[model samples]
Target: MNRIMRESRKLRSWEEMKKIILQRGSSGKDVLAPIDEVFGRKFSVIVDEMPPYISLRNGFTGYIADIWQIISSELNVSAEFQKHSFDAGKELIKNGSVDLLITPVIITTTDIDEIDFSIPIVKIWYELFMKSSDDGATSMSYIVTWSRNLWFAFLLTICILTATLWIIVNIRLRLERNRGKTPPAWQTRLDFWRGYRRWAKGPEPENTLKNELVSVSSVGSSFLFVLGALTNQGNCLKLNSPSIRTATLVTLFFGLLMYNAYSSVLISRLAVGRTTLPFPSLESVAEAKTHIICVRRYSFAYVQFKQREEDKELLEKWQGLVNEPPCLNTTSVRDVAAALCYDNTLILETPNIVAKIIEDYNRSNGCDITRLYGHYARATATVLMKKHFRYRHHFNKMYYFFFYFFSFFSMMINAMLHGGKNFERGTRS
Candidate 1:
């Protein structure tokens, strides 16, 4: 009788639990039910050797691995990570052979229909990387020492000075001729007007205004004098008028200041060994038909180049160059770095990934890589899963909760440390 009572009680307890579960399910309040269904199940995770995201060092360790650990722990699921290239991993996921892909998969329009992505874990942008070369002090350096506006101002000053000198000399000569004084030996010489007379006189009289007025040769001589002063090359022209002497003095001083400044800057630049990039902008890179444009195969960089509409012609040109001889399809960061270092290649990758590559490769290869300043493309990276993943909602929910919690925690720690340092500094002061 006691055994029958115990059996009845056990049946009642099971029935009550079943009724509770049914009610929760009907009301859509059983959030953990799906999780419970898949609890303790092992999932096959596909991963690639993407550093700081999914690395093989020490066996399945990186920021993405950490996130997976948190999500899997909350869901009570185990993951068996399999190493493969990003392309191979996508293939495996498509075939339903892998439950998840944990690399830093960038969300792009091209692949959105083919796969499902979790909430974005990180934002990234594409930057250009190229080999650093020491072609120091290029021929254009002297011209670039002064900006276009400055150079324009300098030329204007020269023209103004030349006109002033020419006018003063002409006025002085007119005064002397009016006083009935004989022309100076230098002034009487025909060489000053020789070319002008031949071009303008043909057979005209000598006393014509065109002849008596300052010859075109005088204008040329004035220009040459001003240019020579600015360049610190003294001229042999003689001036007698006080006004002409005063103008010459001003020109000499202006030239002195400009010449000194230009020389100092040029010398410092040459001494410092400043280097300039052959392709400084995206437009320049596109125009460079001889150089190869390299990017990881099947990466977002490749997708961006093909899909960008603003520079369609440039993209087409880049594609054509990439398809040509000696252009490599880089598959990894290391490969990109190697191409940048050895080949005439321009690599497109995210700033952080490029940083990692440069940091690793520059140490051994002597700092042969550099990243361009501005980014041309942007993307968000997320974990990839098979389309119609059953546990996606739960996984995303837990992932977001943990991610924000940890982010908040880190911010607080940083604030506290920064406040303490400020307090210490105040006390010291």
Candidate 2:
């Protein structure tokens, strides 16, 4: 009872708590030395299997390691940072095996319940990377151009509808019993529109000629609407501007809209049954499940890879090749390559170590294990804490501070790295 009271009292003061923790060997300080030396006792930290940590030569070796050394020296503590798989890291913290967690720690409530954390030492950004050999970088402009293939798709839909409608109209005119009686073209157009409206708003499936004609006419309406919206000609008075040039621009916009609408229909008809970009064939061990490595139950590229039905089918098809995804050999990215079995050639990995990996491989000119498909999922890193830690306030302050600093730098650095005069010089084919 007295010991319990003493422990309660110890937590009341920050210095007393620190002194008590030091005696127990847990230092909340971010440092390089063993935990005992830093806290004046003994302590352990749970870290994810990320490289340059402590196990390998390149493990957390360069600038980051140096920074940790500075922090270690300043705090005068010996800290033992242990590496584990992502899930294992959580388990270690939950089981009270570690006093703190510090590898690219993402702060969250669940994490706080398992382990304590010091001030966030660094910020990590997750990004998508593709092969550099593919001259086009993955950027907003690239995505727009690639997927604006939507315009072509829409145009195709219009063509099929228009042709179907014309055939039906001509057939009905020929079937008319009285040769002298004929519906005007505009009347026929209005009838098509009415049929279209009914077909769209009516039952689940409409199979009659009227429904088919309606569907065709609706397609035309959609083409015109998209064209008008894209060119900003559908709303002229709303775009009223003072400059005489503005009126001229508006007229030009209307002209462009008409051209685009006509051309879209024409192209859709011509390009029927064809696509410019072929579905990349599934070849090589990397494309097969035999060589792909992902952490157990931990989603890496799983979601993104699954999104492509073809990729998912291939994975299922080749699942026989991979008996099981090997336990991630090490958390550090550099060591990760060596752990891959000869049969395994691909590691579904995080987006954050891309630049370093690229630099390393370029410098080595060896086997390449560093290409990414697309973004999988987004999840923030959080620290795990034991129930008694009671250090939520400390972790939150550190997280917010680290988040602000890194986010600012990430934006600035990303812009600088991905954009320049050279980036702007490219022309679309």
Candidate 3:
């Protein structure tokens, strides 16, 4: 009982000492080093397999490795490196097998329960990966121009209805039935409108005729009405039935709206040709029926899909893409990106990571990854540490030091080393 109390007292005193050390650590005292050295302890960092960010094999090497080297140097301590896969790294950090993670992990809700993160080390953008543009105009070009499949259905309904009208008019003509007089040969536009106005107001009854010519004239009127709504022309023949006129008005209304929408979209697309931009969005991806190749599970791309529980269509696409043997290599994301060099590929990945992959790729293949959308660019990604990590404050202080002073320099140096791939942060396509 006495020993238990004494041990508890020791734990309290250690916590008090840690608090004091953290206070001094941030105040430019380098106080953490003395404690770490006195305890003969170092942080173990689990590094994941992202090159140009953190490459861990025989030893740590990459942008993150260089940064960690500087941080360790400044802290007057060394971090032991343990190379692991991304999921394994997360599990290792969560279970306290490691005190730190060299891999830059995105801060997520799931992570909140398992680990603590330093202040953001870097910001990464999300991208919608898609295939190279194809120049051919398809029968589906109306999709881009109309922006909805319902419009196509509506137009098709109009065509079918018009054809039915034509057939009915032909049958009536063959039966030699007519109840209206034919228009004068030299009738003006005003005369046609005058006659239509009378018909809609319930025209006076007159002598009926059973004639094939009247049926032919009705067929001509049906064609005229269809042409006026679908194109820039109007039918002059007045329909006698109230129901038929209402249906014609419905067709005209839809036709007017569709014509305006289609014309505007078509002109814009023509201005910026399809070759310049194909598959502008996920909807386009579905319409184009392009193959989906995802890099890894729990990646930012999948995270976005998970967040969009309401988007049933996109969710379905995501599920379908996952059901195969290595639509992508599950281990290395870079390998999936490298696959883009040959296969028609659209892959969702963090922009900075793939930008490096593309840089390395273009050196040999002269290929490029097309970005259709940028997601999660503002998400905070930081170094992961074990849950309730004793030295979180200490590491956070060190991270802030690097973030303010070295952050800009690191980005500049990277951009200089590789040509400028500096895209604006957080802009969605």
Candidate 4:
């Protein structure tokens, strides 16, 4: 490449070309460097098909894209857009398939070795999302509870077990009137009622009920004990049989845990006034009680955070939290908002995606989303270019100094040119 460049430079007077550029500056066609003039019909870029950024339909609606159009017009060069992925654009820059990438890709430490990036174009902020309260036409008005399907399943299970217990006890009853035994049918029925009453009320059956009978069937007591324990308001029903007592103790322990969980979830939801509760911060999200099915693309705060900050405690905590897979991995950030479409889910993504979602939902129910945590870890998206490209410094200077820094001046000049053209057209008519 050096040999070819030397041969090329020999043909053109490099000194004279430099003098012309110095006089005219970037404002005139004479300022085009030998490198710029080499094969330049139009300076085209490999545009990644990220809508609002670069697309056939949107053309270049994003702020950075608008800025690019301004720069292109200033240089008196037409920009031809070619669509490609970020990876493809990087590869193109490496092999010189394209001059540069127009789409703004976030500048990360990992990318530094491969390609040089232009001056930071747009400042980006990270955001999170949860389902809106007004998700449906009629918002959910019920207290926090498990889904109806779960309740149905539990009821079905209980019914089947209770029926089986009744059948078994009836079949096992023995009627032996010869040895001071009552008729099996009457005795089994009486015992079941007495035992169940004892369990539902208390071991002091006389106090729980005005009248009491001597309990016989331990099976009835066991069944009633399990049911009452589930509500955490069980009677002090102690079984004489060791197995029955042990089972009762076990059920009570599990019931205590379940009831506590249920009550806390209901109370918290009531306080929040929504099924989904607001988290204190991004870190608090990890410990949030709401079991939301989160979804995200690669452009997420957690990914950036884990990659950059090496705080062992934080990394370890986040790593372990995501192990349960808080958010489903997606290829596009737009799809991350799907998490917010559901009942209990969240998305950790950039503000661009959040704005897009809100725009789509504007006329309808309106996005019930809130920022909650922050515009944390402010970042910049930049244009990707070949490492040590001849025009890197010029491109940076063009935006930071000429185009972006003098944006107000450029806008006025553009408006004046547009107004003059319209007036000329009117005069021609």
* lDDT for each residue of candidate 3 in 62-153, tens digit (9 for 90 to 100): 77677777667655676677777778888888888888876655557656888888877766666656455543255456565654576678
Best-to-worst order by lDDT is: 1, 3, 4, 2
Tell me how candidate 4 scores on lDDT.
Answer: 0.54
- What pairs collide in candidate 3? 126-375, 129-346, 176-210, 176-211, 228-233
In the order shown, the candidates' Cα RMSDs to the true structure are 15.4, 18.2, 15.0, 21.5
Question: Taking the tens digit of each residue's C-alpha lDDT, what string does model 1 give over 282-350?
Answer: 678778665777777556666556645233243555666652444455677667666666456677778
Q: Taking the candidates one at a time, how many backbone clashes does each contain? A: 0, 34, 5, 1
Return the TM-score for candidate 1, rounded to 2 decimals: 0.62
lDDT of each: 0.66, 0.43, 0.59, 0.54
TM-score, one value per model: 0.62, 0.36, 0.49, 0.48
The digit string of per-residue lDDT tens for model 2 on 1-429 reads 224223423243434433333233223343222232333433575555443332234454543445445434434545687767656777777787776665543344334544565554444433332222222323332233424667577567445534543454444434432333445788868799775775689654433544433443344543453345445556222211233224334444654755676566555534442212211222434454334443312333333334342343325544543224343533446444443333333444454454455544343334333344444345343445555764445444434433433333333333345543322332110
Error of 4 at 104 (Å): 3.3
Candidate 4 residues 73-178, lDDT tens each?
5555576778776667778877776777876455456667777888877767766666665532223434325566856865675555445433433333322113
Ordered from best to worst TM-score, the candidate numbers read 1, 3, 4, 2
What ranges in model 2 sit over 4 Å off? 1-49, 52-97, 105-346, 361-373, 390-392, 402-429
Q: Predict model 2's lDDT versus the native.
A: 0.43
Give every collision pair in model 1.
Answer: none
- Indicate whether candidate 1 or candidate 2 has the larger lDDT: 1
Instruction: Locate the minimum summed-lDDT window of 10 residues in model 4.
Output: 205-214
